[model samples]
Target: MQLITWNTQWCRGLDGVVSAQRIVDGARAMADFDVLCLQEIAQGFDNMPGAPGDQPAELAALLPGFQVFFGAAVDEFDAQGKRQRFGNLIATRLPVARLQHHPLPWPSDPSVFSMPRMCTVVTVRDPVLGPVRIMTTHLEYYSQTQRLAQVHALRELNAEACAQAAAPPKAETEPSPFQPKLHTPHAIVCGDFNLTVSRPEALVSAPEYQAIHRAHAHGRLQDAWPLAHGDTPHAPTFRLFDRTYGPDPVTADFVFVSDSLAPRVQRVEVDLQSRASDHQPVLIAL
Candidate 1:
C-alpha cells in the first residue's frame, strides 16, 4: 500500500493560489498513492485568505473511486445559518470499514493564540496489511500547552483502540447497532504536527523529543523517518518556500506508525519540490 499525507494549508500554495486541483495533481505526481491523508481543509467560510469554501467536497470530487471522510475540528454556524467547518480529511482506495472524528484537548492557555484541533481516523482493509487505521491531524500551532495536551489525547486514543482490539465485547444480536467494528494496533498517524524537533534523526524511542510534539507512543509508535532514512535529518516541511514563520526551514509535519506497521514501511519520503501548499507531502509505501 502506498499512502501520502500532506497539510494542504487549505489548498493554498506558496504562490498565493488556493486550488484543490493543483494539490491533487501535485500529490499524484509525487506517488501513485492508495491512501491520501490531509490536514487544514476548510469549508463554507469564504473570508479566509484564498479559501474557496467547501474544500472537502471539492477534494472528494477530484478523487472519484476513493472513499472520503472529513472530520470537522471546528463546526460553527453564522447568523445567516450558513455552516462552516475546518479540519482534516482522509481518502482511500481501499475498503473503508469504519470512520471516526476524535476532537483533541483544547485546554485554556491564556498566553498564546490557539484553535480547536482533531484527528480524522479511518480504518481500511489493506490486502497485505489487513485491517489498518489511518489517523491524520494538525496540532495547535502557537501554544505548547495545548499541543502537549493534544499529543496525550492522541496517545490515549491509540491506547483505547489497542484495548478494544485485544478484547472486543460480545454482541448478543446479529446486525446490532452496538456491534464492535474492526480495530487494529496497525495504524499510521500523519499530518502537520505543528511541533518542531531538533535532531529527530538522533532519537529512536520513548519521547516526542523538545518537550516534543510527536508522542513516542511508549514503544507502541515509531517515527517512520528514522525507520526509512536512519540518522539523516528530516527534510523541512514548513516555511521552505515561504519563511514567514521562521528565518530557517523546520519540519512540523510527520508520519508515525505503530510498531506492528513499522516493518511494512518499505519507503518514506518528502516531496521537497512541490509548492502546492506550504507543506511538502510525505509518502509511505508498504
Candidate 2:
C-alpha cells in the first residue's frame, strides 16, 4: 500500500493560487497512493488568502473511487451565515470499517493564539494487512503548551486503541449504536505535526517529541522514516526554499507506524520539487 500525507495550506500554491485540482494533480504526480491525508483544508471560507473554495468537497469530487473523510477542527459560521470548516482530510481507495474524529486538547493559552486541533481515525481493511487504523492530524502550531497536551492526548488514544484491540467488546445480537466497532492496534499516524522550527532556540526541541519516540522503543509505535532509511537525516518537508514562511527549511511532517507494521515499510520519501502547498508531501509504501 502507498500512502501520502501533505498540508495543503488551503490548496494554495507558492504562486498564490488556490486550486483543489492542482492539489490532486500534484499528489498524482508523486505516486498512485492508495491513501491520501491532507491538512489545512477549508470549506465555505472565502476570506482566506487566494480565495480557497469548498476544498473539502472539491477534493473529494476530484478523487474518484475513494472514500473521503473530513475532520473539522474549526467549525464556525461565516459572514454569509453559512457553516465554514477548517481541518484535516483522509481519502482512501481501500474499504473502511470504522471512522472516528478525536478533538485534541485545546486548553486556553491567552499568551499565544491557537485553535482547536483534531485527529481523524479511520480503520481500513487492507487486503494484505487486514484491519488497520490510519490516523491523520494537524497539531497546534503556535502554542507549545497546547501542542504538548495534544501529544499526550494522542498517546492516550493510541493506548486506548491498543487496549481495545487486545480485548474488544462482545458483540450483542441486536444491532445498535452501542455495538463495538471494528478496530486494530496496527496503525499509521501521519500529518504535519508542526514540531520543527526555523529558529534554533525555539521550543520545537521539547521533550514531548522524545517521549513519542520512546513509545516506539517500548514496542508501541515507530517512525517509518528510520524503519526505511536507517539513520539518514529526514528530508525537509516545509519551508524548503520557500522564503514566504521562513528562511530555514525543516521537517514538520512524518509517518509513524505501529511496530506490528513497521517491517512492512518498503519506502519513505518526500517530494522535494512540488510546490502544490507550502509543505511537501511525505509518501510511504508498505
Candidate 3:
C-alpha cells in the first residue's frame, strides 16, 4: 500500500490562493498514491483569505471513485450563525470496512491559543494484510500542554485498537452494528504532528518528542522513517518556502506504522519541491 499524508493548510498555497484542485494536482504530480491523508481542511469559513468555503466538497469532487472521510476537529458557528468546520480528511480507493472519528483530549490551556483536535481512522481491506487501519490526525500547534495531552490520548486509542485486535468480540449471528468489526494489528498513522523546529534534529532529539516516541513504541507504533531510511536525516516538511513561521525548515509531519507493518515498509519520502501548501507532503510505501 502507498499513501501520502499532507497538511493542506485549507488548500492555501504560498501564493495566498486556496485551490483544492491545485492540492490534488500537486499530490498526483508526486506519486500515484492509493490513499491520501490531509489535515487543516476548512468549510463555511469565508473569512479566511481565498477560502472556497467548502473544501471537503471541492476535494471530493476532485477525487472521483475514491472514498473520502472527513472528521471535523473544530465545529462551531460563525457570527452569521453559519456552520464552520476545520479538520482532517482521508481519501482512499481501497475497499473500506470501518471508519471512526475520534476526538483527542482538549485540556484547559488558558495561557495559549489552542483548538480541539481529532484523529480519523479508516479500516481498508488490503489484499495482502487484510483489514488495515489508516489513521490520520493534526495535533494542537500552539499549546504544548494540550499537544502532550493529545499525544497521550492517541497512544491510548492505539492501545485500545491493539487490544481489540488481540481479543475478537463474540461474533453475532446476524449482520448488524453489533457485528464484530474487522480487527488487525496492521495500521499506519500519519499526519502533520506539529513537532519540529529550526533544529534539524527536532524530529527525534527533543525530550518531549522522545517521550512521544516511547509512548507510541509501547503501543506498537514505530516511526517509519527510521525503519525505512535508517540513520538518514528526515527531509524537512514545514516552512520550506514561506519561512514565515520559522527561520529554517524542519520536519513536523511523520508516518508511524504498527510493528506488524514495519517490516513491509518499503520506502519513506518527502516531496520537497511541492509548494502546494506551507508544509510538504510525506509519502510511505509498504
Candidate 4:
C-alpha cells in the first residue's frame, strides 16, 4: 500500500491560483498513491476568493475511483451568506468501512494565528490487509499552546478509536455507520503537523509532543521515515515558491504508522519537488 500526505494550501499552486485540476495532476505525478491525506482543503468559504464552493467533492469528482472523506474543521457561514469550510481530507482507493471526524482544540488567540484544526479517521478494508485505519490531520500553525493541546487530543482520540473497536469479541456488535471491526487495530496517521521534528527549539520538542511520543513509547505509533531511514535530516518538506529558497523549507508534514504495521513499512518517499501545494507530499509504502 502507498499513502501520501500533503497540505494543498487550499489547492492553490505556485501560480497564485486555485486550480482543482492542477492539484489532481500534481498528486498523480508524485505517485500512484493508494490513499491521499490532505490538509488545508477549502470548501468555498466566502472570505476566500471563491467562497462557499464544494471543492472537496470537486476534487473527488476529478479522481475517478477513489472514496473521499471530508472532515470539516472550520464550518461556518461567511458575511456574504455563503457556506465556508476548512478541513482535512482522505482519499482512498480501498473500500471504507467506517469514517469519523475529530475536531481539535481551537484557541481564541487574538493574533492572526491559530485557525481551527481537525483530524479525519477512516477505517478501510485493504485488498491485502483485511482492515486498517487511516487518520489525517493539520495542527495549529501559529500558536504553540493550541498545537500542543491538539497533540494531546490526537493521542486521546487514537486510544479511544482503538478501544472502541477492541471492546468485545462478539461476532457482531451494534451496527453503526461510523464504527468498524477491529481485528488488530492497524492505522496510519499522516498530515502536515506544523510542528517540525527537526528543530529541538520547535514546539514538537516540548512536553506536549513528548507526551505524544510517550503514548507511542509502547510502540503503538511510530514515524515511518526514520523507521526506514535512521540518520536522515528533516528532509526539507516545504519551500517558498521557486522565486527564492529561504533559510530552510520546514519539515512539518509527517506519515506515522501504528506499531503493528511498522514492520511492514517497506519504503518512505519525500518528494521535495512536488510543488502542487506549499508543502510537499510524504509517501509511505507497506
Query: Which pairs clash (backbone N, Cα, C closer than 3 Å) in model 3?
Result: none
Of the two candidates 1 and 2, the one with more favorable lDDT, higher being better, is 2
Steric clash pairs (candidate 4): 44-52, 44-53, 45-51, 45-52
C-alpha lDDT of candidate 1 relative to the true structure: 0.85
Per-model TM-score on C-alpha atoms:
0.93, 0.94, 0.96, 0.87
Error of 3 at 97 (Å): 0.5
Model 3 poorest ten-residue lDDT run: 210-219
Ranked candidates (lDDT, high to low): 3, 2, 1, 4
Cα RMSD of predicted structure 2: 2.3
Query: Which whole-number lDDT from 0 to 100 does residue 35 have in model 1?
Result: 97
lDDT for model 4, please.
0.76
lDDT of 3 at 29: 84
Model 2 bad stretches (over 4 Å): 197-205, 216-219
Candidates ranked by TM-score: 3, 2, 1, 4
Deviation in Å, model 3, residue 255 alpha carbon? 0.3
Give the RMSD in angstroms, all C-alphas superposed, for model 1.
2.4
State the lDDT of candidate 3 residue by residue for 126-209, as single tens digits.
887778899999988888788888777777778788888888899888998888788878889889888866676655776446
